[model samples]
Structures are given as C-alpha cells and as structure tokens.
Target: MDSFDSGGVRIAYIDVPAVGGSGDPVLLIHGFASNHAVNWVNTLWVRTLSQAGYRTVALDNRGHGESEKLYDPEAYGSEDMAGDAVGLLDHLGIGRADVMGYSMGGRIAAHIALDHPTRVRSALIGGLGMHLVEGRGLPAGIAEALEAPAGTPAPNPTAAAFRTFAEQTRSDLRALAACMRGSRQTLSRAEIAQIVVPVLVSVGTLDTVAGDGPGLAALMPNARALDLAGRDHSTAVGAKQHRDGVLAFLAARP
Candidate 1:
C-alpha cells in the first residue's frame, strides 16, 4: 500500500489497475474497524472489480489499518474521513469516479456524494440503508466496548461484535473508540434527497443494523435498493449476491 497526506493525517491506500488496461475508476471505502485488505482485498472485491475492467482504489481511513491513528474524537467525523477519500482521488489526479463504501464507510461515501457531488460519478452504499438518514449510526456501548479491559464483557451483542472484530483486526482500540464516539453523524431526509447522482443502496434483508434498504432508496431521486436475501451485516459484505448486485448496478450506471 502507498501513503499520502490528507489534511495532515497519513492515509494508506492501494491503487490497482484493471487487468486489461486503464478503465473507469472505482474508489472503495471499507467499514469501521476494518481496513482495505480485510474489507475489500480478502473479500475479493478488488479482484472482482479488476477482472470486470474497473480500476479499484481502496484506502484505510485515518484511524484504521496502516493509516495514522488519532485519539481525538473530534477528528473522526464522517465528513473528515470523506475529505481523506477525496484527497486520495485528488492525489491520483482523478476528478471523478465511482465510489463504494460499506457500513460506516457507506456514511463517508454518502458524504462524498452529497458534499462533493462533482467528484462522484456514482455511489454504491452497502451494508447501510435508512439508518444513514434516520439513525445516528452503530449503537451506544461500542465505544465503551472498545475501551473496556480485555476480559470485560460487552453490554450487548452489537457492542461485543464490534469489540471482537476490532480485536481480530488488531486495531488501535483507543483510536477506534474515538472514531466511534465522533463519527455517528446522520444525514437528514432532505439531504439524502439532494444526492442526484446514480446511486445503489444495497443491504442484507436480514440485517438488523442497517435499517431498511428499500426505504432508503425511496428517499433518493435516482437510487434503487437490492436485498441480499438471507444475509446479515457480517455476511453481506462478501456475499456472492452482493457482488452480483454491485456488478449489475455498475454496468447499468449512467
């Protein structure tokens, strides 16, 4: 992975060209507590896109993966992380590209599509849905779980899942805790409605954490939803259904 300075934070990223030749760029943002490799590479998303002739670029948000970690909660806002993503595109001289993000990264991608509309050709939001507008994101206790002592039990299943994932990824728990504390900003209904670019909102039908997929797509003018039947948040990211849906969406994007 390569590194770049984004608003004074060091962000790590990998830029992979399409197998045949240069192609339309696709910027990928991974979910919280997960990095480029775990969320995209290990999931075969990079390969999937590359084989389909789309250049894939993925980045580690400031506090995750090989990026510089920050402990200040204020530094982890979704908009701030969105800026890092835009900066990566600017660094690579890409003025616009297809952007995709999962879960928390979906929130950041939403910010990019909304706040920097000119830089986003299309947006693919995965593992997220109406929660991007209605809810605050994740849940309470996740930050606490990240900060708890190693043997301490989390207060709930969701928190425990996050804690276990952070541990599995060997994340900087304090940095992720601060990220959790600061990055839960949600978009309003009116704001979501203003995203005019082609958009695909996909979520697992069985997911409890992402709100309603069809409900969210209904709020956007040019967005549609894909239900990953029988999948949940944990299983949705790499599911074959998800990949197929995304490929179809990209193929049909204007």
Candidate 2:
C-alpha cells in the first residue's frame, strides 16, 4: 500500500493498475469500521476490477485502516473525507475517474460527485441508498458501542454488530467513535438532484440499513438502481450479483 498527505492527514491506499495496461481509473471507498482490505481486497473487488481492465485505487478513510486516526469528531466529516479521496486523484494526476463506495463510503462518493463534479466521471453507490438523503447515518448507539469499556456487551443488535465488526477489524475505538458521530451528515434532495454524473445505486433487497435504492436513484436525472436479490447489508458487498452488476454498469457507463 502507498501513502499520501491529504489536508494534513496521512491516508494509506493501494493503487493497482489494470492487468494489461493503463485503464480507466476507479476510486474505491469502504464503509464505516471497514478498511480498504476488508471491504475491497478481501471481497475481491480489486482483482475483479483489475482483471476487467480498470485501474483500482482504494483508500482507508482517515479513522479506519492504517491511516492516521483523529479523536476529534470535527475531523471526520464526509466532506473532509471526500477531500482526502480527491486529493489522492490529484496526487496521481488523474483528472477524472469513476468512484465507487459502499455504506459510509457511498456517502463519501456522493459528496465527491456533488462537490467536485468535474473530478468524477461516474458514481457507483452500493450498500447505501435513500438513507443517504433521508437518514442521519449509522445509529448513534454505534459510537457508544465503539467507546464502551472492554468486555461490555453491546446494548442492541446493531450496536453489537458494529462493536464486533470494529473489534474484528482492530480499529481504533476512539477514532471510530468520533468518525461515527461526525460523519452522519446526509445530503438534501436538491443536492442529490444536482449530481449529474452517471450514477448506479445498488442495494440489497433485504437491506434495512440502506433505504430504497430505486427511490434514491429516481432523484437524479441520469441514475438507476440494481437490486441485489435476497442479499443483506453485510452480504451485499461481496455478492456475485453485485460484482456482475458493477462490471456491467462500468462497462456500459460513458
């Protein structure tokens, strides 16, 4: 993995070239409590894209993975995180590229498409949907779960899941707590509508975390949704259907 400085924070990332040669670059953003390896590499997204002839660049959001962690809640806003992603493209001298993100990463990708339209050729939003506009983000209890004393049982199912996942990933509890609290900002309908770049909103049919995929996609002029049949939030990212949909979407995109 390589590293770069983004707005004073050191972000860790892996830049893999397409199998044959230079190919269209694609920036990958992982979800909350997940790093580039867990969400992308372990899921075979890097290999899939690379073999499909797309350059893949995946980053660890500030508080997650090998990147420097900040305890300040103000330091983890989606916009700030989005800046880190764009900075990577600038660092690589990429003028524009397709952006793909899941869950929290999906929100960050949307911010990139909205705030830096010129830098995004397309946007693939997975594991997130209408919630990006309607909901605040992960439940507040998730932050508390991350901050709970060691050995304390999580208060609820969602919290327990997050707590366990964070622990499994060996994340910085304090940094993840702040990130959960700070990065919950949701985009407005008008803001979603402003994103003109071609967008694919993919979500599992059984996912309760992400709202309605088609409903969210309908807000944009050039967006559509792909339903991952019978998949849930946790299983959706790595589903073969997801891989196929994304590959097809990427192939068909302008």
Model 1's alpha-carbon lDDT is: 0.94
What would you estimate as the lDDT of candidate 2? 0.94
Query: Please, what are the lDDT tens digits per residue for candidate 1 over residues 97-127?
Result: 9999999999999999999999999999999
Assess every candidate by TM-score: 0.98, 0.98
Candidate 2 lDDT trough over 10 residues, lowest sum: 135-144
Alpha-carbon lDDT, every model: 0.94, 0.94
Q: List the residue pairs that clash in candidate 1.
A: none
RMSD of 2: 0.8
Model 2, runs deviating above 4 Å: none
Model 1 reaches what TM-score against the true structure? Answer: 0.98
Candidate 2 residue lDDT tens string, 5-93: 99789999999999999999999999999999999999999999999999999999999999999999999999999999999999999
